[model samples]
Target: MRRKGSPHLVVIASDPADAHFCNVELRKLKTGAIVGRHYILRSDVQTFVSMYRRDGFSPVEGGNND
Candidate 1:
């Protein structure tokens, strides 16, 4: 998980040997515990992040450089 601001952003890709899948996890800032998790197709990552942004999560800059 990468620390952004109030929450930690974790984007986990499924096993390389299997079909491509992506899991996004939102973790609590204080305790580093998962607050929510979602399993989504790799193509939907942007849509998912957009929805979260609409719900008030700040965008993380620099893509996945962290």
Candidate 2:
């Protein structure tokens, strides 16, 4: 998604026990921090990913942390 210019993604997991696995191999992108924590339950990940996909990305929403 980031290759397509997506500024963020909210990764989700089906199990809380597996939740830590969600972020295990992933490297934290500075842009990723803007959306706050990326880990979430599998149930909600799709909703957020869909919303951002449909609406497109806005780097400004990440706030002026710079």
Candidate 3:
């Protein structure tokens, strides 16, 4: 998994539904975008948001406005 910081491991889902949920989470952290983290819809909202910060994500309040 991404948390383990390993290159060989990938978090595989059981089906398309699971993949979609994972995609929601993955897309939140895609390309290291900060503000993007807010789009993650899940029960562990706090935990999910904290992971980004714990892994070195910066201020997520402001972003490009052009």
Candidate 4:
């Protein structure tokens, strides 16, 4: 979700890996305030969390809190 006039956007990607990647991109896209993109990775969160080993956190497979 995103709110108009907000400094930052809420990005929701398809998975944690994408989310993590998006998070980095978002920051890089804008400095202080400018065009922005937020991501929420929920579609394949399990794989997202696991494959993205950089964060040291992963979601359980087949777990759908959605």
Highest TM-score scorer: 1
Give the TM-score of each candidate. Answer: 0.60, 0.35, 0.30, 0.25
lDDT per model vs. reference:
0.60, 0.42, 0.35, 0.37
In model 1, where is the ten-residue run with the lowest total lDDT?
A: 57-66
lDDT of 3: 0.35
Tell me the deviation in Å of residue 17 in model 1.
5.9
Better of 2 and 3 by TM-score: 2
Full candidate order by TM-score, most accurate first: 1, 2, 3, 4
- The candidate, 2 or 4, that scores higher on TM-score is 2
> Over the stretch 14-48, how does candidate 2's per-residue lDDT look in tens digits?
44467433321122356444445455544565555
After superposing candidate 1 on the true structure, give the runs of residues whose Cα lies further than 4 Å from its correct spot: 1-19, 61-66
Candidate 2 residues lying further than 4 Å off, grouped into runs, are 3-35, 57-66
RMSD in Å for model 3: 10.7
